[model samples]
Target: MLTKEFDKPLQILDQDGQVVGPLPPNLAPDRLLEWYRMMWLTRFLSNKLVALQRQGRATTWIPSNGQEATAVGLATPLLEQDWLTASPREMGGYLQKGVSPAAVAYFCRGYPPPPELVGKDARCLPFTIVIGTQTLHSVGLAMAAKMRNENSVVVGTCGDGATSEGDFSEALNFAGVYHAPLVMVVVNNGWAISVPSHKQYAAKHLAMRGIGFGLPARLVDGNDILAVHAVMEEAVANARAGGGPTLVECVTHRQAAHSTSDDPTRYCPPENLALWETRDPLKRFRRFLYDGGYLDEKADKALTLEIEAYMNEEVQRAYDYPAPAPESFFDKVYAEPTPRLARQREEVRQETGAKR
Candidate 1:
């Protein structure tokens, strides 16, 4: 029987969507339905983003198709005041923190989020494209919060590939030494772009790395939202209570090409691909909701269609936003441009022949 000991990767729901262990606190049927909707929205919107790339409307996008549960579960337990610092493929976290779908659409099209919608609106950080860098950023933020005696806890996430980065190691080391109020989550999808994880490390589970740094750690089923959410709640609570940083390794799979620019079929293992398809997080969660009488076919279809229609409208709105100017990159560097940046900005403007 499954137990709270969590000696193995925790799994609350099995392949058939049957509960195999205890549910998390306050997991009412309504909340479960809400969680399912978020997962669906993430996958549905993410698939449309992939299409945007194919149609040449977007430069490229990171697809989070098979990893919905980890993204959603990782963000669910976080308070409005807590921080969510993430690398890309975390659409669910953005939406969970009340990010506008239109803003996400705008960002995916290579534009900054309209400046008005950030700051007080959400504690979530802008998407970081450079792998593993967000880990350090979050750790630094948490250390600052600790110094100021604030209650915020920072949650940082990265792909399995980031574990090899010097930044990842340094961030973990710093957090451990300082006991920063941070939680680091590794969305271990078993492959780093074209490279399988076995080639990256000899350790069986990435969670063990945390133990090496004197932080609590757990390996959880990333597809099992119940398990993921519960584990994240404990980690977040631990950090908030001054217990220091905790590391969680969520084992999931990337269902699509790493990004619109890469091709997975060239190297992804066929047998493993077939296996993970059956473990699709959205399907599994939807089935759990159905079995528990929280959802019916008609209700599911209606909600999904509503979201689908809204997605198109929002994406179109994103496309309608004026394209970014060539020199706009220098605009946000500081409250006022540094003298050197002002000169460089002027040079770019002259080269582009952009009218003043």
Candidate 2:
């Protein structure tokens, strides 16, 4: 149920990097550089994480190649006090929230990864493996904030595929009823694994789903960082002002496989991937900066080198952390081991000699 006026996604910059709308909010002289840096770091982090998976250092990893704008823009506007429930591919959010690239790389190496503490006091949750579960967690955090009379707003992010989950619906319903200070960002990347978005729902945008739950829904060009940042700023402000939850649908495309285990070439069309390539978020933003004379060739090349060296250090640091012990799960599940847990621990010890 999208109104005719809202049918089209909002755009602040065209694919060629020309401004197509008013200037995005928070446009300080250095803000553009900061935004581009975060996006670049995210892409590099993704490549490194995916490489780890392929190198047998990690089992699988999510990539955020095409959705850089959606991840960074939405996360950039958030304050340190605010909470963010992360989606698997929002590596930009993790980096922006003060979680080190090394910590992130290390997290991927652990089987099943760590939960919640992945970001610690940074207020960023670990990358969620269960699709829409973070939505509920966000609402709960918002409610707790309200109860404590704290002004912290909570942001929960998810993919279009997660909008179909019952937990998402429930989260929306509860947030609406309580007027929780929350922002819900749904990135419609056109495919849920091999399933095309056309088969997911009849609604023109996933934001429409929030409308039914009493949330204000907005659609933005996910590939355009300006548009994504502007819309996110507005939504976050609204929620912080006690205006209730707002849902934003970021229209983007997943340019690569869903994960290291996925092969999009088998099910996704080449034409579609090629089309999105022309709309790469980082490319468009970089072009805009160059056109505006905000970024010179020297600065651009320097930043590229800086990011490469920075990420290399991060990857090396990630390697410094030892892998989890095989029997760590049993010993760390609780302070005192129960009889059943002891038995399980003994069984694992007997089988693998996992001593520590």
Q: Each candidate: what lDDT?
A: 0.86, 0.84
Q: For residues 1-356, could you state the per-residue lDDT of candidate 2 as single tens digits?
A: 22224668899899999999999655986888988998999998899889878889875788998888998888888888999997768878777777788778877876434444244567887678998999999999998998888888888988888888999899999999999999888888998888899998898778778768878889889999999988888888888887888988889989789988888889988888787679799889998999999998999999988997898798787776667767677866779999999998878877887454
Candidate number with greatest lDDT: 1
Q: Point out the worst 10-residue segment of candidate 2 by lDDT.
A: 111-120
Number of clashes recorded per candidate:
0, 0
Error of 1 at 193 (Å): 0.8
TM-score of each: 0.94, 0.94
Error of 2 at 3 (Å): 9.8
Residue 112 error, candidate 2, Å: 8.6
The positional error of residue 178 in candidate 2, measured at the CA in angstroms, is: 0.5
Q: Which 10-residue window in model 1 sums to the lowest lDDT?
A: 1-10
Off by more than 4 A, model 2: 1-4, 111-120, 331-338, 354-356
